[model samples]
Target: MALLPTTAQAAQTHPDPRPLTGQEIIHDPTVARLKSGGYVAYSTGGIIGARLSADGRHWDDAGNAFAEPPAWWYEYNDKADPWAPDLSYRDGRYWLYYAVSSWGSNHSAIGVATSPSGRPGTWTDHGKVFSSERTDSWNAIDPAIVRADGRLWMSFGSYWTGIRMVELDPVTGKTVPGAAVHHLATRPDAPYAVEGPYIVKHGRHYYLFASYDACCSGVNSTYKIKVGRSASATGPYVDSAGTPMLNGGGDLVLEGHGRFIGTGGQSVFRDKGKDWLAYHYYDAEDDGTPKLGLNRLSWTKDGWPKVS
Candidate 1:
C-alpha cells in the first residue's frame, strides 16, 4: 500500500498563513477614547502598558505606562494578578482602578493610579482604595468607578455574592462612610457566578452591565455579559421584564460563540457621538486564547442596548 500523509505532515507542509499579533494575547482590556481622537487600552500580564489607535482597530504599542507596582500593594501581600481595570477621565486627570488578588479568593483589593494625560510613564499610584476583609461576606474585585448624578460610585463583587454599589465622594474618589451599599444584582439561583461590573448612563437610565460564570481556562469558559437598568444611579435596577437585579434580575446581553467565548470585563464609551463596547473574547485564530474585542452598541427603539 502507498504511504499516506499524516495530519502533522499536512500541517507542516501547509502551515496556517495567519500570523498572531501582539493584540492576540492581550487580555482583560480596558479602553478609553482619548480626548485627542485616539483610543488607549490597558491589559493584564503584559507590560503595565497602553496602546494608541487612530481608528480603534490598528494599534501602536505605547509601551509600559506605569511599570512600577505600588509599594503598599506589595506590602499587603496581595497577589500580583491584576485584572478588570476601569479607566476614566475625571477632574482633568485620568484615573485607573485595577483589582489585584489570587484567583477565586477574597484576599483582593482595588488600587488607584492617576495620570495627567492618558499616556505612558505618567501614572502615579494612589494606593489601595477598597479591599475585602476576612469578616466580609462578599468577595471584592472588579472595581469600576462611575461619576453619575454629581457623585461617584464603585460597583464590584463576584461569585460569592453579586454586584454591589457604594457611593464615593466625588473629590476624594473614596467611599463615603455610612453610605448604604446597595445590592444591585445577583444570580443566587443560576450558579451564583457574577462579577466584572461595568456601568454606563444612557439618556435617562443607568445601565448596569456585568459578566456571569467562569472566565479563564480556555475552552471550558462559560463567560457571558448580562445587563439591567434603573432610573437612579443607586439602583433598584430591573431587567426588561420587570425582574429586580438584586434577586438575580438581568437580561442576557452578549454570550459566547464557539471558540470565541465572550468573557465580559467590559467598558463602554462614546466616540464621535456613537456608542462602542470593548471587551475580551477568545480568539479562534489564536487557539482560543483571549484577545481584545470591540463592537459598536446600538440602542433598540424600546431602549435596550445590542452589540452591533
Candidate 2:
C-alpha cells in the first residue's frame, strides 16, 4: 500500500470538500466502491441510511441497509438504530460492519452483515460481532477493519477509554473467542474524547486516523481528524515527534476552517490507483447540515498522508 509522493501540497490553504448534489445529508458515512461500477454509502440513521453515486461526485439517496433492525438490536437501543458503518468488498461479497448503541451509554455492540450485491436492500444480517458493557472501560461504538499479517483486526471505541482493537475470525467477521482486547489510542485526560478510528496500511506502517473532541453538536462541534502511526496493527502508535497516542499525542490531519466545520468521522479508500478520504462535516451555510466530504489523499516525501 505504498503511495508515491506527488508534488507537495500547499501548506497555508486547505481544500474544501468537492461539491455534491442530491441527497447530500448524511452522518458518520462509510463508502464502498461497488462491483457494479457505482458506489454505495451507508451512514448513521434509520437502519443505516444509504446513498449512491455513479461518479463519486454527485450523490443520491438509495434507502437503507435494512428495512428494520434485527431483533437483537433492541437490547442495546430501544429504537434499534445503528450508526457508523464500515463497508468493504472481499471474497466476491460485500461485508458491512456497523455500531449500535444509545448516546452516552457504554452498553454497545458492533454488528455485521453481508450482501452478494453491495446494494442497499440486499444485505443479510450477521448480528453482533463485539460489544461492551457499562463496566468495561472501552465502549464498542465505532468499528473499522484492517487485514494485516494474514489476520483480520477491528479497531473501535469512543468516549469511554478512547480506541480499542480485537482480532476477528475472517470467515465469520466476529471477534475471536477469548481474544484479548488491545488498547490502541486514548487521551490521557479523564473523560477521553477521542474516537472514530479508521486504520490504513501505507508502505511499512499502519496509520491510525481518529476524530478528536466533541461531535454531533452541529455548528458547535469541535471534531477534527488526527493521525498516529505504528509498525504493528495493534500498536503503541506515536506522532511525528515521537509522542505516544495514549498520552493525547497525535498530528493534526484535517480540521474546521471557514465554512466547513467539524471535519471528522473519516475513512480512507483506494479508487483507480489513488486514495481518497471520506468523512462528514457540518456546513456552516446550510444551517449546520451534516454532509459528505471527500478529498484526494496524497503521500508526502516522508511517507505520511496529505489530503488535498
Candidate 3:
C-alpha cells in the first residue's frame, strides 16, 4: 500500500537503525528474545527470514523459519515473499503466525507454525489460520497477537479497511469459536490507509499501535507509527484527544525524522523488566532498504507510551 509522503521526513543527516553487519534487507519483522540470552527475528521472506542476535546490537543470519514452506503458499504469492510474521512461545512450543499475499491483492492468508525451540529449520507448518479474497473489503496481512486478561487475541489488516481483530484459541492456534471480528482502527479518508496492528497491555489500559500511510517505497516511503488505547481489550479505543480509533484517531508514537523513513510495522516486546519497540524503516541514504529498528519503550506518568 505505498503512497506519497505527507511531509518531508526524508533523512537529510545520519541514518537511523545504525547498521547490522550480517542482518540487512529486512521487511516487516518480528522478534523473540531467546532463552539462551540472545534474540531471534522472523520477517517477510520465502518461508521467513531468520536472524540471530546475541546482544541485540550485533546480528547474524540464522536461516529460514521453515526449511521448506508449505505448498499452499504458492497459491498466494507467485514470487513468495511471505510477509509479516508474529512469533510467540506457548504450550511447550513456539507459535508463529505468518502471511502470504501479493501487493495490492486481497488473495491473502495467515498461517501458523510451531517449533520446539524458536530456531529456524525447526518450525512445523500448520497451514492457514485466516484469509481474505477479492470479494472481501479487508486485506488479511500484518498479523500481531496479544494476551489480555486471560484470552489470546490476534490483530491484522492493511490498506482496505484498516485493522481487524479476532479472539484466538491457545491450543488450536486458530480463532475461538463464536468470536466476532472486531474492527479496531481505520483512517477512513480518501487514501484510507492504516495497518500493522499490535496490542500491548500496559497499566490498566490496552494499547493498540499501527502504521499509517504508504510503506515499502524505500527512502520515498511515508509510513509512521501511531497508537490508541482502550479500557477493555476489545474497544472503542481512543487517542490522547479522546478521538476514537474507529473514527480515525491515533496518537503519534514515532515518525521519520533525520534519516529514518516510514517508522512503522512494529512490535512491542518486554525484556528484563523493560519494554522495547522493534520495527523496520527504509533508509533514505541507503536507497530506502528496510532495516531493523530497536528502541527502548517507556510509559509516561499519565499512561502514554514514549519510545527512545
Q: Could you tell me the TM-score of candidate 3? A: 0.92
TM-score of each: 0.88, 0.95, 0.92
Q: Name every residue pair that clashes in candidate 2.
A: none
* Least accurate 10 contiguous residues by lDDT in model 1: 11-20
Which portions of model 1 miss their true places by more than 4 Å?
1-22, 75-79
Clash count (model 1, backbone only)? 0
Candidate 2 per-residue lDDT, tens place, 1-308, comes to 99888987776556898888888899998987777888888999878999999999889998899987899999999999898999987778889999989999999999999999989999999999999999999999989999999999999989898999999999999999999999989997878999999999999999999999989999999999999999999998999989999889998889998888999989988888888899999999988999999999888888788889
Instruction: Kindly list the per-residue Cα lDDT of model 3 for residues 1-308, writing each as its tens digit.
Output: 99977986764332355346667667788887976679998888657989998878788888898777689999998866688999988778889998999988989999899888899898888988888999987888988888888789899999788889989898899878777889988876945699889999999999999999988888878888899999987887899999999889999888887678888889888788889888888877787888888888889999999876
Write model 1 residue lDDT over 1-308, tens digit each, in one string. Answer: 99887755432111111232444456667888887677888876633556777767677777766776666665334545576778888999988888777665677777788888877788887777778865776667788887787889999888766888888777767778787767888876755788888889988999999888888856667788888999988798899999988888888877776456756667787888988777777766567787777777889988898886
Report the Cα lDDT for residue 167, model 2. 99
> Against the true structure, whose lDDT is highest?
2
Q: Which of the predicted structures, 1 or 3, would earn the higher lDDT when compared with the native?
A: 3
lDDT of 1 at 90: 92
